[model samples]
Target: MAGKSGKAFDFSLFRRLITYTNPYRLTFYFVAFSAILLAALSIVNPYLLKQVIDKTITPKNGDLLVYYITLMLVFLVVDVISQFLFIYFANWLGQEVIRDIRVKLFKHMLGFKKQYYDKSAVGRLVTRAVSDIETIASIFSQGLFMIISDLLKMLAILGYMAYQSWELTLLVFAVLPLIVYATRVFQKKMKAAFEEVRTQVSNLNSFVQERITGMKIVQLFTREETEYANFKKINEKHKKGWIKTVWYNSIFFPIAEMASSIVIGLIVWYGGLKAAQVDGMTLGLVIEFIQLSQILFRPLRQIADKFNTLQMGMVAANRVFAVLDTQSVIEDNGEEELIHVKGDISFDNVRFSYIPGEEVLKGISLEVKSGDTVAIVGATGAGKSTIINLLSRFYEIDSGVIAIDHTDIKTIKLKSLRDHIAVVLQDVFLFADTILNNITLNNPNISQDKVEQAAREIGIHDFITSLPGGYNYNVKERGVMLSSGQRQLISFLRAYVSNPEILVLDEATSSIDSHSEQLIQDATDKITKDRTSIVIAHRLATIKNADKIIVMDQGTIVEQGSHNELLEITDGYYRNLYEVQFASATTTE
Candidate 1:
């Protein structure tokens, strides 16, 4: 049953492919016409040969023989040109269709939420985006056009043979059922073999990519030989999969050939007897029947193989559809834009969970005025980041409502709400582009001066200007080209470039050196002076100037007050953190 489902390729994906090719419908129509012309012209050749042998050659009519021969040569030229035209158009259409599908798939993947990446393997996604799409292209280029051409030629040949000698045609096709039955069985086994091949290849690809990405760690730990053995084991598994695939393909062609040969032999022997018994059976007629029999059965063998190729394509289509069919749990609800946002934020009895029955935040209530600075301080896993995530609507809250500017976030457009906010995380992510481009990613209209101002505010402009390429210096992936402090400074500039009303600093300075951290601290002060800021920090010293600090432990807030007020709470978590920092400062002095 599962095998049947695999064969039941989604026609919608094919339909999508057709839609892409629709713009070039003229090319396809010409291709189809060219194929039909070629098929019609092929039928003429046999009749011409029959005439030359039965009439011209036997009767010694040199003029008629010459005329037939000239006609045959003309058809040969026309037919070759038509075949070339069909192939050229088919290839052209196939390439364009694949290009469109690839672009669409890439764009779709981009729109997916962060949660999508959390559950999907990069290797698997990359394979679907590349190799699977190529399979679709191959099917259209070879499989689709071949099916059309072969079926037409097969039908025309069979029809002609029946017209000439039905009795011999039926006798020759008697073993067709057995061939088809064998093909059906082989197809099932081949499907399994190919599916296993795909799986093993995906695993091998995933393992190799992961190992290469982490090669430094592997070599540092001195596990090269161990990793080599593991890789060899995976490669061996892939080899076994291909071996089974080869076996199925190997068996299918021989059985098809044997069946074809047996049928043709029977036709030859029977036809010879028929010619001897009937005076109407000419030698020319008998040879034509023999020649036509080969033509008919040859395509039968090829048709079965093409069917297998089509089946393999169907199997690949299932995987491609599986990716396109993924329903994003987090959707924009067609609300990605709104006119104005006041930036007043509130979480009223909000609740959430990463997984069912394991709530991370429970009935948390918090409100911040339009321009107030609210700092959340806690140990690790205290739901500090969760609060900001909810406000940003990255994940849907389990219960209760989160509102921005007194409007429920669900009703307001997601893009508009998020457009008013900025988040600078501890681990900064930079693209392999220039520094200016990274800073102004969300707002490309910003001038070079504006970008430099933002960077200088964070105190990284001087250092960046000293680089060989200056502002155009290409940062390596994940900003590996720069130190941790430099990356954080650029991240700060990125957030400030947006000029957001609501700014979020989630451990933004935790990885930076003390000097750079102070520079970032000064920039944060200036940027958040008139904005609503939510700082989720591990370092309590940084939030001392914050308007209000809400101290949390586990998933709930344990204290909420000014810095002095929280510090006076003798045995509180906040008080303990402050005392440790004070003692450390005195000891260093």
Candidate 2:
């Protein structure tokens, strides 16, 4: 529904699509010239046949016949070469256009804010970049200039037909109205059918992509049969959309073929009757008319189908352009650079919400002094993570100032601000690559030695080497091969490798085995020492040594103190949470 456009055969969108050809203007001109050459050459073969038939075959003049045949062969060779150029260059142009557009679209998508991703489906975006853009290539390869060439050739054949025998040409013209009416009807039907087909194709692509990505969940929940049924239903709709186009084709093509046959047969019969009475209506002329009619009708048939291809391409273009037209990206207008940061961060009365009319972070204020470690503990939906999200500029705050080192974050360049802060989130994402690549994220400047040093600092080098291939081990997609604790260690390595001035750990040590938890605590201690660290954890015991502890409830900070100071308040929120967690741990032991 996002890219829904009823704008079939729109000239403005067509012109916009053509602008991509500017970079390859020379190739575009050559492709167009080939189409024109092919169109002009299409008339030569029919005339050569006429010359051979009337002058040579009937009179048995064999000597000149060889010359005409040789001339025809030369034209045939030129035609073949011209055709090859048209096809090769046309397709090359289309591929180049799609490639450029795909790259631009991908770069545009990369700049969008997190909210854009929250609402859009990953599969739908893939369709926009991949299959939908692929359809646009047909616009150039077979759609625009192709229809022009066919029309030009049809006109040339008709003019030649009239020159040879006006009466037969008139007879051929008589069949044109019927074919025109059928084609007009067919075009309208096919246009609607194609739009539906493209929509269904996108739907099918989205369904398949999401299913494959979540195959593990499907199997774990034993919903294979249910998802299969769902897939079949979508597949059936996709088939029906294509079938509708076929149904229209089945009707239109036969009418075109029958009309072509009727025209040829009528010319032969009428031209024979008038051959003696009418001047220039020779047997040879009738043969020429028959040949001309086939050439003309063949492209007319193609014209109808190519129009549908062009329509389908426009439909795909509309979808792709919708994403490019989106203005959902964060504006980076700051000129201030963070050449050096003291790691002092403060939020003064900041308020923000993911959705309108529902506040997630109300006018709350906090501060982290340079080199100080702070811990935020809260229940779910208490706005614990939203604070860090704002601090990192993942989302803009609604009503207050967030600053780093006494400079307003809004005035500081986004990359510069983020460069000084390292955030290790709860969910670790690793690409299917070697662990070294995952830790450094393929940053060439961070050498193997640097990664080993960072891993050693986080106390994960021995653990990484204990694996099959040491630091070079392939972790596979999303690090599924490694345990949860191992993935966390990799994240720690990733954060430490950057050597940021500030580090934020969001619940890094939750839900781990005791042995791994001890290793993680050691790694956490090593990474947080002498750095500005903000830790968000549900386990209160883990943050007992935190320099300052803050407790949040319902988007407001209700308590703030050290662990001992908070425990002094018997009925305080932090004291109650600590008592509950500590009691739960004691019972489990």
Candidate 3:
């Protein structure tokens, strides 16, 4: 959702954006120099026209006339060169500024707490990073620098006209109040229209992104016609938002054109009358004033249009700055470096809540010994996944102490802590890249030999070689090119290559076929040998060989022991859960 704030023109936002150009100050100065030169060169053509009419052509002086014409040609060449410099340098500054800001914004997002993304829309964040940054680029490339050049040119033309004939100059400016009033009103209406258009664009992006991601559900439910109708309604609203801007432009430009033409007409008429009645007022001066009149009023009309680019850029800058100002980052205050951990984990009086007053884990305590394989089984929403989330420090508990080897986890550097652990989530995410690169994640330390060796050790090397491209095969966006089971196997190879001291498998085999499950179980056996392992599973059959099993219900541990030991408890929670959640898996196995 995009919203509008502040006045029509926000000077504070403009000031903030200008500071981004500090790194490119030299290029900005060159652009400023070019604008000044172009503005100074613009007045020469009209002044030379007066000289030709009064001093050369009127006196029948052929030699002087040729000289003035040649001088005009020289000025024309310089003007073209100055315009080129201004355009090139202005665009360069704009592009460089946006590049830096985009990188900074992305880096900031990477450090944000998981909670921030949990509440934010992917499409809205995408729009801010891409479309909004492009809009800000227009401020320098087409808005601010161009406005300055036009304004300076207008001032030069006005000064020359006043010097030539004060009477006609005053008359031309009589229409100023009317043009200014119309421009102010146009700006107010267009600002609102542009804000609405941006909001609709973000909405359209979010809707399309979500629908495409969940397209299987839509098709399975046979909601194609209904979805199409909904899209049309959103598209219609987007169309209407743009149409409102066009309507305002359609009305404003015509009025500005008419006003400019009327001013030129009045200048010609009044200047002619003065030449006949007043002393030192000649026909040539009247003609020169008409040319000057056109130059002055043209920029006035162009300025109104350029103002729209400026206003839109300001609005976009406001949105980007808001994201940068967010204080939801998980502070990395840990000074302790975790070089080699012993893999012992402890939870003491841990109390946590995703939302206030809705606690997910309540004062639970547990200890995991070194090299032990612990399986946690629980009903849906019974705080099973929450344990993994806390162990990885993806979230901070409301009140508790979680430690590794007797040191509080809060004292360990985030990078050092996470670097030693690997998580293979049920919903595996793979980038659109080669399979080998996905496994190694392009880490230089993990060579091709190491990756291939790890894949073989995990028993997926033959499966990879069976594919058309072997490890070079491209897994399209989100690994859509691969089957669900194949994707799961790739995730296993990825975690294996990392060679983490601690391994976490969260329902890794829940959605796989029996063959894939067997492969995963074999890989799990090899990888978890003499290493810490935590498995959260709904299917009890997979965790039967785990060293210990912890049964959870309502955010509390209800049963804890080995598989046979837990079954020995008469009518226990683990027994009931196994009968209800794992019976199908057991029969299939």
Candidate 4:
């Protein structure tokens, strides 16, 4: 799928697009019906002109000439109405399809796991959602309508010409085969150019979004000039892409125009010579032939342009379908919900790795009894966070049996499993919304009183009250308006307010200063009174109160005991870690 040439149109993607069009089937039918009616009206106009020249004007019948003129006007009015109907439905269908596609794309994007985001760029995804969808919409409204209307008109003209004089029709149409051949050549180049232009535009959008989002970093480093230089490179690339497309279009229309002109010249010379015979062509017939030349060649050129747009739309459709087709690596099991959870957690011979042949968690055995606070400490990259991730089922373990209350977590529904637990990471994320919303994000059903109570318990209520709007104050993106200590305090409140049976704090207090850390630790001890708690922290002082401390190194547990037990043991990882911290604390003071 990645290496697909996209030279041939992807019929499957078109089929999917057409499925979305099914809801607007009646509108599409009306559009097609109106196109055919308009073509019939076109045929009637030329024939009416022929009649006025032969049966009315040539015979000096002034009354018949007036009647023909009146009839032509009526045909023109009907053609206008039919064209209006066609345009209305075509535009409506295009908008409707775009709306549906946007919803589906957004839903699919939301379902993607973190790994998908880790690999794919935010710019590339945004391009697929916005720019690609827009390009396809343009193709629908203009390109699709032109294809239908022109095809019908071309067919009507060709049938009328064949009936009038096959020889002359064939003679004039000598350039048509050339037109089709030329169109195919132009279509390939134009399609390639359009795809290149879309790609370049997508890159530019990504650059803009990244630059704007990171404007602070750029400004702080005084790298505005360098950033602008980088932006100019991408902007120039986009310009070159559009210029290439224009160059191809420039050649295409001129060649088509020249061919049409040559065909018209041939019609004038040859039609006149043929009219010298007794059964010669009528004046009306010559005029009709001239009109037919326009009817045929004009649509031929339009068809060429429509084909180019359709080809470009196909490229976008392929990309959109690629996103919809991606499978989520983790899914919930359809099992009974565990509403009443006992928070006893156990890992039976757990062995896991993110990549093959490089294990991050070795075979180990451990258990946390219900209503116990267990602390996990390790050197960097020692799989402390990996264990927490598995417990939460963010990623499936390669080989392990992780059970809560002796029930394997994989056997329980994902929603039920996650609902029973809560986590607060050191680096917390907050939306650009009120503090009230961020605290109650986990459970909106929770009352405002409860939110305030949780904040007060975490010792941040007084601080929030000091702000102008208190809980209603807006947090900037990522809670940037607040200090780091404040962000962690809010996150702690959010996690504690959930009141889950199991709580996991992944270095939750590591980012704060000594004053905030002490406040958070006091709250942590109170919150863990009757709940299952797992703490992953580097600071020994934070977890000294835990019932048990498991010290890890290189993906394997090396020491497990109470804080004092491990600290008293010689040559233990915990003892060495504690001594270093103790010495560092004295040195700092």
Q: Highest lDDT: give the candidate number.
A: 2
Worst 10 residues of 1 by lDDT: 1-10
User: Residue by residue across 529-573, what tens digits does model 1's lDDT show?
Assistant: 888899988777888999889887777778998898988887988
* TM-score for each model: 0.90, 0.96, 0.97, 0.91
Once model 1 is optimally superposed onto the true structure by TM-score, how far is the C-alpha of residue 573 displaced, in angstroms?
1.0
Local error of candidate 1 at 490, Å? 2.0
Ranking, lDDT, top scorer first: 2, 3, 4, 1
Native-to-model Cα distance after best TM-score fit, residue 277 in candidate 2, in Å: 4.1
Which clashing pairs does model 1 show?
A: none
Badly placed stretches (over 4 Å) of model 1 are 1-30, 57-61, 272-280, 334-342, 581-589
Candidate 1, position 157, lDDT: 79
Q: Residue 289: error of model 1 in Å?
A: 3.7
Q: 1 or 2: which has the higher lDDT?
A: 2
Predicted candidate 4 versus true structure: per-residue lDDT over 1-589, tens digit per residue: 4216645455566667888889889887887788888778778988999899999988999999999999999988998888888888888888899889989999888767665777787888999998788767766777777687888898988998999988779877798888888888887777677778777877888899888888999999999999999999999999999898788789888888988888888787778777766788877788778888887888888888787788777777767777888885467764868788879999998998877788999986789989989999989999999888899887777787999999988898888888889898888999998898888974659888998888777677898888769999999888989988788888888888888999999998877888888778877887788999999999998898899999888888888989999988988889989899999999999
Cα lDDT, model 2, residue 80: 93
TM-score of 3: 0.97
Among these predictions, the greatest TM-score belongs to 3
Better of 2 and 3 by lDDT: 2
- lDDT for residue 52 in candidate 4, whole number 0-100: 94
Consecutive 10-residue window with the lowest summed lDDT within model 3 = 1-10
* Model 3: per-residue Cα lDDT over 115-189, one tens digit each: 888999888899989999999999999999999998899888888778877888788788877888998898888
